[model samples]
Target chain A: MTISTMRLTGVAAACAIFSINAFAEDSSLTNPAISAVLDGYYQSAERPMSERVEGFGLGHTEVAMSANIDDMFYGKLTAVIEMHDGETELGLEEAFIQTLAMPYGLSMRAGRFLSDIGYLNNQHVHTDAFSDRPAAYRAFLGSHYFDDGVRLSYVAPTDLYWTMGVEAFKGDNMRAADEHNERDYKSTGVYTAFTKIGGDAGINGSWQAGLSYLRNENGRMTAEEHDHVAVLDEHDHEHSHSAQYTGENTYVADFVYKWAPNGNYKYQHLTLSGEFFRVTDFKPLEEEHDEHDAHDDEGKDYQDGWYLSSVYQFSPHWSAGLRYGQVDTQMMHDDHFDPQKLKETEVSLAWHQSHFSTVRLQYTNQQGTNFDGIEDDNVITLQYIMTLGAHGAHQF
Target chain B: MRINSKQFLPKALKTLTLAVTLGFISNAQAEFNIFACEPEYAALAKELAPDARIYSATTAMQDPHQVQARPSLIAKMRQADLAICAGADLEIGWLPMLQMKSANAKVRSTDQGLFFAAEQIDTVDQMKSVDRSMGDVHAKGNPHLHFDPKRLLGVAEALTQKLMQLDPDSTAQYQANLARFSQRWNDAIPRWEQKAKPLNGKKIIAYHSSFKYLFNWLGLEQVADLEPKPGIPPSSSHLASLLTRAKQGDILAIIIASYQSERGADWLGERADLPVIVLPMSVGGNEQSVDLFSLYDSAIDLLLAAK
Candidate 1:
C-alpha cells in the first residue's frame, strides 16, 4: 500500500481501538442534553459568492424559518436548492417540517422527511449534536430516504426514562430526497419505550429502549419485470441474473443508555448517550425467467449499529462536545449480522454559540470492514436557530 | 423599567403576524376561549382571538404580585380555551390561586388551560432564588423573565404549540401566522439587544424585587430595595439601613412603578439624592411603555439618561 494509504489505515485502526477502549469507560457530559437542535440551512441570500458553505452534494442555498406562534406551538420550515460546483440543481436538499405541538409530548408531522433511524439518521443540519452526520446515515439513507407518509410520535412520560410512538413511511425519498420507487406502500410499526436509570449527577442522562415491527411490499417490480434467468456458477458476480429483492418484511428492536444533564441555564451541563438498532426476521425473493427462488440472504438476516457521544456546556453562552459513532449491518447478504462484533469509530467536536446557533467541526477515522475498509473525511458545519413568538410552552 | 407613553401600542401588537393572519383568513367563523393572564397577552388575544371569548383578571398596571381572588379572573379561567400567562412564577401568586378556585376541569397545568409565556419565550433570571431577607423576591428566580425578547422565543413557541393543539382546525393558519410573526419578532431582536447593551453593569435601586430580571437583562447591578421584606413596606430601620448603604454604593437611579406607592420611593430617592424615576412595568402603565418595544426603549433611556 502507498504511504498515504498506510497512514490512513493506521489512523482508522487506532480509532477503532480507541472506540473499543471508550466503551470500557463511562462517558462524561459537559453540556446540556436538552438543548436546541439547530437546522442551519446555510444561505448567502444577498452575497455575491456562489459558494460559501456549500459543497459535496450539499446545498449552499438553503432557507430555514422557525417560529413559536404561541405557548403551544413551535415549528420550522426548510427548503433548499442543491447542486454541484456550478450546476444549477442536483435536486432539492431539504423540504421538511418539524411541528412539536400536541398534548402529551406527541407531535403530528407530515411532508418530506428524514428517516429517524439510528442516532444520526435524522439529525438536522442545525440540530446535529455534531457538525457532520455519520457515514451510516449517508450510505443507508443518503440525501433522501424520501417516502411520503404521516408519522405519529409520542414521548412517554416517565421520570428519567423514555417512550416513543412512531408511524412513518416505509419507502425512500422520505427525509432525504423525494424520490419514488414503484413499490406498494406499506404502513407497519408499533411504539417503543426507553429508560435511563441513575443519571442524577446532572451529567449522565437516562437510558433508552424500544420494540418496533415493520412490514412492507418492499419489492418494486412484479414477476414480469424481465425475461432472463441466470444459473450461478459459484462466482458471486452477476453470474446468475435475477431480481434479488421481490417482497420483504422487516422488524427492528432498539435500545439506548444516556446520561444527559444539560438544560439548566446556559446548558452548562453534560451528557453521555448511546443507542443500538437491530433488524430481524425479514425475508426476500429472487426471480429469473419464470421461476422463483429465495433471495441469496433470507431467513433472519439481521444488521445493527450503535454510537456513544458526550457533550459538555461550560456556560450557556458557550459549549463543547464529542461524539463517537459505529455501524454494522448485513441486510443485503445471506447471513445475520452480530452488531456487537462489527465495528467502526467516529470522533467529533462542536461549539454552540448561543441557544440558536452552533459551529461544529468533526473528523472521522473509521476502519474494521465498514466503508469498504477505507475511511477518511472531514465534516464542518455552522448551525443557526431562531424562534419568535411567546416561546413554546414547556411549563407542563 | 421606565415609564413613558410610547408603549400605548407596540409595533409588535399593531402589526402582529397573528393579527394580520386574522385579516387574511376570509373565513372568520370559528369561536374559541382565550385566557389572557397579563394585559399584553390580553391585548394580543383581542386582536388575534377576536372571535374567541376573552378571559383575564389583571390589567396592564396592576401588581401581578398582589392580585388575588378576583372572581372575574376565576370565571374567565373556568371557560378559557387557553390560559396564557407570563410564566416563571410571575403569575404563580395569583394563577395558582385562581387555578385552584375556578376548579375549571379544562384548564389544568396538564391541559390547554395552562400556558406559560416565559416557557414560550426565552426567559431570564432562571437561576435566581428568593431568600427570607430579600423583600418581595419571587423565590423562583426572577419571575419577570418576560422582560427580555430573547426569552420571549420560548413564550411564542409554547403559545404556538398550544394554539395548534386547542385549535387544531387552525393549525395551518396558526403555523403560517406563527412563521410570519416569528420572522418579524426575530428581525427585531438584534436592534433591541443593541439598544439595551449600553446599560450593562449600571448600578440602581428599586422599591421591590420587581427589577431583578430587568436589571439582569440590562446587566445592571442592583444596590437595594425600598421594601425590607417580600410583602412588607420599608420600615424605619430599613430606611436607616438604606441611609447607611446609600453613600458607598454608586447608586445612579431608583425605579418606581405607577401602581406602587411613591412615599417609600420618594424618601429613598431623597436620601440617595438621585432620580426617583417612576417607570411602567407593563403595557398601558405609560404611553411610551404602552407597546412592548417602547416599553424597553423608554426603560433604557430613563435608566441611562443623565440626571
Candidate 2:
C-alpha cells in the first residue's frame, strides 16, 4: 500500500508540474480567471430563523469564473453550492455579460444578476462585515433580490462621482410567497431606477449616498394579522382568520461613509452605513368571507423599515461591529389589527487573517410583536469565510 | 402633453448649453491627458510631454500592489487619453477592475493607448516557474524596473514613441524632449555612481522584494527579509529567528520603503542595535525626493547616514 501511494504521489507531482508549465505558456491569456469562496458556520439559536441554522452548516459557498469575452464584452458566471435539509443543492447565483466599451460613459449589463437597489443588496454575503444581513433586508428583500435583468447605467463626467441606472427584470425570483395561491405574473414584472452620488471628503475619508425605486407590476400577497380576530365555531373550537394584503411599490435610500487613515485599509478603518426602505401602494386583497371587508376601504396601507450599522477595525487583524434594524408593517389602516413590528440587534467581532480570509463570532437578539405574540430570542454563531484563486477587486 | 413639452424644452436648452461650454473648454486645452499608476511614471511623463495633463493614481505613501478602485480614480481614467502602469502583475489587484469599470476604450489593455512600462525593458529576476508559496513572485520578473536608471531611459524612449504615435502633431516636440532628457539623465548617472561607490557589496534586510531593482542597480545584497513569506507580515517566530541572524557582525541596518509599517523593523532594530533606514522608494516619497533625480539622491543619502 505504501509503495502504491508513493507511486501515485509521484505521478501527481509530475502532472502538476506539466500543467503549471502549460498554464504559463498560453492558458492564462485564453482561460477565464477562476475563483471560489467557502463559507461555513456553527450557530446556537433559541429560535430558528430563515437563515440561522442550529448546528454546523454551509453558508453561501460559491465558485465563479470571469473574463473579457472580446474587445466589447466581459462575462462572469457564478455558481452556489450548499446543503439544504441534508440534501446538496447546486444553483446558479449570477451569469452576466457587461459592456466593456460604450460611448458617453454608458454601460449595459444583461443576464441574471443582483439588483443595484441598495448598498448591501448587490454585494455578496461573504463580503458583508456581519454574519447575517440586517433584519429589514431579510423581511423586505429576502436578504438579496437577484433576478434575470437588463440594466443600463450612465456615469456623469463630473469632478464629483455620480451615476444613474435603470433595470428591468423577469421578477419571478424577487416576488414574495403567496400563501393562498391567488396571484400570478408573466413577462417582465419588475422595473427599477436608481441614482448615486459620492465624493472623497479628504485623503482619509470617502462617502456615497444613493436613492432607488422599484416598481413591481404584479403585487405581493401578505397576511394581515392585525385586524382579524379568532371566531369560535358551533363546536366551541377557536378558528383564526386574517385579511390579506397586496403590495406593489418599494423605495430604498442608502448611505455609506468610510474612513481610513491616509487612505490605507491595511492597518485601520471605520465604516458607517445605513439604509431605509418603504413599501407603499398596498391594499386589501381578500378578507375571507367579507366579515372584515370594512378594512378593505381603508387606504394608506404601507410597510417601512430601516437599519444602521458601524464596523471599526481598530487593528490590522481585528474588527468589531454593531447593527440595529427595525421593520414595521401596517397592512390595513383599521385598528382591529395592531401594527406588526420586528427589531433585531447584532454585535460581531471578526479576525481577518488576511485580505482573503476571515473568522467571525456574532451575537444577535431579536424582539418583535406580531400575531404570534411577543417574541424574544438570542443567537450565537461562529463563522469563517475563505476565498481562493483569482478573486476580483471589491468595489467601494 | 403641454406640460411635458415645457419641461422638455428647458431641459434640452440646459443640456445644450452645458455641452457647448464643455466642448469649448476641451478644445481650448487640447493637451494629451495621461494617467500613470505610480508617481515615478507621472513625473516621467511630465518630463517627456511637458504640456500633457497627468494624474497619478497612487502616491509614495500608498502601496501600489493593493489599491482601492475608488470611484474618483475611475472618473480620472474615463477622461484619460493614455494610461501607463508597471504591469508585470504589479497592478493585478486593481488596475483590471479600473479598466473594465471605466468603460474607456483608450485605457483597455488591448488598446494602443494603454502602455505597460515593464514590457519596454527586460527586467531582473524573471522567474522560469512560480507559485503562491514562493511569496507573490511574478513570472514576468520584478516590476520595480523604474529604480534602474538604465532601464528607465529605455522606457523613456519607448514612451516618447508612444506619445508621438498617439499625438502625431507633437512628434517633433516629443523627439526634442526625449533628446534633452536623455542627455541630462546620462550625465547624472555617473555622478550617482560616484556617490554610491562606497555602498557597493553592502548587505541589508528589507521588508519585501520592493527594493530588488534598486539593490541590483546599486550592487547591494539583500541579506534577509523581514516578512515570513512574500505578501505576509513578519510574525513573532520569524522575527525571533532573524534576531539570531542579525547578531552576525557583517549585516548592515534594516531598510524599508516609506509606505511600509515601521513596527517590525523598529523591533528588530532595537534588539539588534542596528539602524532602521527608511528609503524613499518612489517620487514624492519624501520632501527631498520631489522628482526622479532627487528621489535617488534622498535614498542614497539615507543609506549613507545609516552606514
Candidate 3:
C-alpha cells in the first residue's frame, strides 16, 4: 500500500478508537485514563540516517492506559505501534505498578518500564522539543531503553529537591549484542543507581542536575567484530564484520535549566539541557574458534559521548531548538573497522497548535570519521505528534 | 562483651525511627505546613491559620492551569500537612502528578490531607457534558470562584473546618480567626458591590472564564472573548470578526488577567479604540494586591477606571 494510504488508515483507526472511548458508558473510578500519541515523519536525504528513515514513515506511536489500582498502588500500560521497513509492528513499551503512598517519601515500581537514568530517558518522545533524542542516547541506549525491572526511589525531606533511586533489570533488551554468545547472562543482568537534585533558580527559572551509574553483570555492549566474521555489505559484496566489545559499566551525567517570565510558561520560555555518557571496563570478545584465547581479550577499552541542547519558545505557539552531539567509540585493531567518532548537529522549529498537537521541521548534519565511507550527510525532516484522549501531565 | 552486629542494627534503626517521629510530632504542633495550589487559597489559609507555614505553588504571574509539576513543587507537597487547591479540575493538569510523585500518603486525592476549595462551594457555569474540542471546559463548573465574595466565604468556612480537623489543638484559634475574617469580609463585600454599581449592565471582552463569578456577582456582561475558543489563542480571522462587534461601541473595555499575555487584548483595543484593563485575578496579582482585601479593591479600581 502507498504511504499516504497507510497514514490515512492509521489516523482513521486512531479516531475510531477515540470515538469508542468517548462514547463508552462504563464510567467508574477504577477505569483507567486512556490516551494515544500519533507520530509520523517525512524525511529527505541521500542516505538513511541513524535514527530516521528515508521518505515517508510512521514514527513512534503509543497507546497508554493508567489508573490507581487502589489507594496504595498505581498501574500503567503502554503499547507502541510503528512502521518498520514498510511493515507495521507492535510492541509493549511500558507496563508497571508503582506504590502510591509509601511512607517517608519512598516509592517502589515493578514490571517493564523505562529506567530513570538521565534527564530525557524516562520522558515520552512525544513530549520532546526535538523530533529525536540526542546522538549520545541513540548510540549508547538504542534511542530509549526499557526492560523488565524493579525500581525504588526516595525523595529527601529537606527543603531543596533531591531524589535517589536504584533499579535492577533483566538486561536482554539492553545487551549490545543482537545475537547471544556463550557469555550471555542467565537472569538479572543490569543494575543501576541514580541521584538527582534540583531547586528554583529564581521566580522565573529552575535548574536540576543528576548523576547515574549502570553496571552490567554479564556482557553489557558489543562493538563491531571486525576480525574473522564475514558480513554482506549493503551493495551485495562480502566485507569483514565489526568486532564485539563487552562493556561492564556506564555512567551518565545530565543537567537541565528552564526559564520563563515570572514562572509563566504559557507564552515564552527557554530550556537548556545537556548529558554526558561514558562506558568503561570494556573487553573485546574473540570469535568462537578463539574461545581459549582469553588472554587477548583482557585489555580494557573505553568510550564516551556528550550532547548539549537549547530550545527557546519565541511565542506561545512557536519554539526553535538547536542541539549538538558527539560520540567516540574505540574498536580493536582490524581491517574492516577502526575507532570511529561521529558528531551531529540539529536545528528544529516546532509549531505547537495547542497543548495536544505539534508540527516540527528539523534539519540535521552529521559528520563521521572512519564510518564505512559514509562520512558526511545532511538531512531534513518534517514530523508531527498529536495526542488524543486524556493526555497526562508532564513531569520534570 | 561485643554486641551482635545484626541485632545492634535493628536497635539503631528503631531509635532513628522514634527520633524522627518525635521530631515530626513536635513540628506539626508548632506550625502546620500548608501547600496551596494558588495564591488566593494561600491568603485564605493564612487568615485561618496565622501560625501555619504556607507555600503557594503558583505565582500571581502564572496561569494555574498551565503549571508544570516541577520538582520543587513535589518536594513541597511531600512535606505539607494539608494541601488546599481549587479543584473542579482547575489544577487537574499538575496536581495529580504532584500528589503521586510526592508519595506523602497524607495528601492523596482521597486523603483527608487534601482539600478542594471549589468542591466545598457552589460554582456557576457547570456543564452536563464536556469535550476538549470545547477548549478546556470543566465538567464540574468554572473553577475561578474565588472572586465571588459569597462563595469565598463558603470556602473559608469549609477550610477552617478542614484545618481544625487536621490540627485539632488549634480549633479555638481557628474559630476566632474565622469569625473575625468573616465579619470584616462580609462588611467589605457590600462596599465592593456599591463601588461596582457603575459596572452593572456594562459590557466588556475577556480572555477566559476566569472572571465568570466576578461578572455574575457584579451584574456585568461579557460581550465577547478575545480567544475564539476558550483555550485557543485569538486568530486574526476571529479578531477581525470581533472588530465589527467592537465598532458597535457596546464593549466598555477589553479585560485581561494579570497573568495573561496582552497581545490579543492589545490588538483588539488598538483596532476598536477601547480601553484595555489588566485586572488582578487573585491575591498578589499586582504590587497593590498584597492580600485578598487589596486584591478585590485593585480589581474594582481598575475596572472602574476603565469604565
Candidate 4:
C-alpha cells in the first residue's frame, strides 16, 4: 500500500475507535462520528491525483485536529508536516483554544492561527470548494502564514447590526521563546463592527474598518552600535549589516453589499464587495562614508496594496463578474527598489450547476509601473462541489 | 420617590408609549426579508411569499458550488431577514464570505437565518465508506435533494412555518396558501405515480449520480453512472466499461444533464445505438421546461417517449 493509503487506513481505524469510544461513553454524541469520518476521508492524504480528477496539488500537507473539552472551552492542535523528497519536515501550523458557547455572542480564542484576510483563509484542505485559491490571496497573504495570537469577537443586536473584533499577536516568525529572546515583538489590531440600516431600500451592506500597530526588538543590533576602544591610532572600523527585518504598523478594511428589493425578488440578486489593505514598516538606516569623508543617511521604504471586485448574478445559476486589482508593493517598488508599482486586472465568469456545486473561469493581465514589460496569464477551471452535514452562515 | 413620581406626571407620555407599542407590534407582521442562498429554495419562497418579492443570485442553469465573493449578493443579504441554503459544501466558498460580510444581525447564526436543506429534506447518496478511494467527497451524504418533488414539498412546508413566525400577522394567509399548494400537490401525486408506473424497473445509465432521486421517483434501476464516482466524470476506461455493459443489455439508454459535456454521452450512444435523452434537472433548463411544474413534466414525457 502507498504511504498515503496506509495513513488513511490507520486514520479510519482510529475513527472507528473514536466512534466506538463515543458510543461507549455517551449516547449523546449522535451521528457526529459519521460526519467526522466523512470529513476525515476528504482531508486524509489517501486520495490519488489524476487528470480526470481535481489533481491533488503539489507541496501541500496538513494534520490538524480540534476538540471541545467541555461546555465553555474548546481547543485545537494542528501540525503541518511538509514533505520534500519523501522526508519528514517539521512545522507548527495551528494550535489554539476557544470558548464555544460563549455568553451573548461574545467569544474568546487564543493560540497560533491562520490570519483572516481574503476568502478561504480559515478553511482546511478537504473543505475548500476549489483545489486552489485566487491570485490576490497567493500574492498578498503568505501561503500557510499563521501566528500565535488571541482574538475577541462580539455581536451587537440592532436593525443596524454590529459585530466587533480585535486580535493581538507576536509578529510573523516561526521562532520559539527560547530561540530568540531579543527578537520578541508585539502586533495589535482593532476592527469596527458591521452595521445594517433601512429595509428594502435597494442598498443594504456590511462594512468593517481596522487599525493595527506592531513593534520588535533586536539587542544584537543595539550592541553593535557600541564602538569599542581601538588600540591602533587610527580606528580601522569593521562593519556588520544591521538587522533590517523588524516590526511595522498596518491598517486594513473591507466592505460588502447585498441588495434585493423586498429580499425575495427575482431581480434582487445584485451584489458588490471590495477590500483595501496597507502596511508600513519602519526602516532604520545606516550611514555610508565615501573616499572624500562625506556621509549620507539612507531613507525608509514601506509597502501597501488594495483590490476592488464585483459580481452580478442575473439568475440563480448564471452570472458574470469582473475584478480590477492593483498592488503597489511599496516595499518592493520603493526608492531602493526598481519597480514603482504592480497592477493586475482580472475578469471571471461562473455557473452554478446546482445549489451544492459550481464552476468558475478567470483570466488576468498584469503590468509593472517601472517598465518591466508586461505578461498575460489565463486560467480556466471547472469545479464540482457537494455539501452535507452542519451548515453555516452565508458570507455575503 | 418624590422625584420619580414627578417624572411620570405626563399623561400624554403614557398614551404615546401605548401607541408606539401597538405600532411596533403591527410592524412586526409586515413581512420577512429572506435570502435563499441556493436556487432550490427559490421555488418554495414563491409559494410561501407569493406577494413578497423573491430573488436568487444563482439560477437553474449554473453550478452553485463555486460562486465568488460577490458584492451585489451581499447587499441583498444585509437586509435579508433570513438566509437559507443547501448545507454540505454546496456554498462553502461563497457562503462563508457572505456570512462575514452580511451586516444583517438576523441573518447571522444566533438568529437562525441560516436554514439547511438537509435539515428539512430527505437526503440520499450517503456514503458508508471511509476510504479515500471513494474520492475527495462530501461528508453530508449527497446534497442534491431538490431533484425529488417530495423534497420540494418539504422545503415549502419549512418555508411556511418560518414565514408564519416572521410575519405572525400574516400567519393565516401563509397557512391558507400552504394548504392549497399541498392539497394540489398531493392531488397530483397519484397522476404522477400513474404516469411513472410504466417506466418502472427500466435499466438506465446516468451521466453522474445526478439522477439518483429522479431514478427512485420513477422506480427505474440505475445500472451505472457515466462518471466512475459520484462527482467525477466518466473516463475513457469507464466509457469502455459502459459500452461493455450496454452490449450485454444491462443498460438501456444514457441520461445526462444539459450543462454537462454530451460528447461522452453521444459517443456511447453512437457505439451502442442507445438513445441519448438530454433531461432538464430544473425549471428553465430547456425551452420546454420553463417552470417548476413543467420541469418534471418534460422529464416524465421524455422518459415515457423513450420507452
- Write candidate 1's Cα lDDT for A1-396 as tens digits: 101111224345445444533532333521111112223433222111112344333322334334333444334444333333333332223334544345544555565454444333344443445544443333233322334455665443222323344545534321111022354444432222222122122322333344444443432223323223211111132111111222233333444343222212212345455655443332233323323334443233454445666666554345566656555543222222112222434344555432333454444444444333234433344444432111121111
Chain A vs. true chain A, TM-score per model, equals: 0.53, 0.82, 0.84, 0.58
TM-score of each: 0.43, 0.87, 0.89, 0.59
| Cα lDDT tens digits for candidate 4, A1-396 | 111112234345445445544553454653232212121112111101111112222233333344455645666655443332333343456677776555444667788766543334445543433333332333334322356777676544334344456666554331111122354432332221222222223323333333322223221111113234111111112100111112244444555555543242222255555556454443323311113222122233444556666666665456666766555542211223222355666565666543334455545455555322334433344333333323323443
Query: lDDT for every model?
Result: 0.47, 0.77, 0.80, 0.52
For model 3, the superposed segments whose C-alpha errors exceed 4 Å read A1-31, A46-51, A178-180, A220-246, A285-300, A331-337, B1-30
Instruction: By TM-score, rank the candidates, best first.
Output: 3, 2, 4, 1
CAPRI quality level assigned to candidate 2 from its DockQ score: medium
- List chain B TM-scores, each candidate: 0.78, 0.93, 0.91, 0.82
Residue B292 shift from truth in candidate 3, angstroms: 0.9
Using DockQ as the measure, the top candidate is: 3
Question: For residues B3-57, could you state the per-residue lDDT of candidate 4 as single tens digits?
Answer: 5656666766998999889877965664567677655567667766777655575
Cα misplacement distance, residue B269 of candidate 4 (Å): 2.2
Q: Tell me the tens digit of each residue's lDDT in model 2 across A1-396.
A: 010012224345445444544553575553677777889999886222245457888888777778889888899887666555554545566899999778878899999778888899888888898887786776566567777889998877665777789999877644543434565665697899998888778888888899999987765545545444321011111000111222488899999998887776666788899999988765435533336445442434577889999999887678999999888765333333346777889999999766678999999888877613438878898999988767457566
Q: Model 3 over residues A153-267: C-alpha lDDT tens digits?
A: 9988767889999999886644544322545455887899999998898899988899999887664434344453312123122110111233578899999999999999888
DockQ of 3: 0.65
Query: Model 2, which residues run further than 4 Å from truth?
Result: A1-30, A46-52, A180-182, A222-246, A285-300, A330-338, A371-374, B1-30, B128-130
- Model 4 stretches astray by more than 4 angstroms: A1-60, A66-77, A82-92, A95-111, A118-145, A150-167, A172-281, A285-300, A303-396, B1-31, B64-79, B86-111, B125-129, B136-142, B249-252
Q: What's the ranking of the predictions by lDDT, best on top?
A: 3, 2, 4, 1
Worst 10 residues of 2 chain B by lDDT: B129-138
* C-alpha positional error of residue B229 in candidate 3 after TM-score superposition, expressed in Å: 0.8
Candidate 2 backbone collisions, by pair: A226-A337, A227-A337
Candidate 3 docks at the CAPRI level of medium
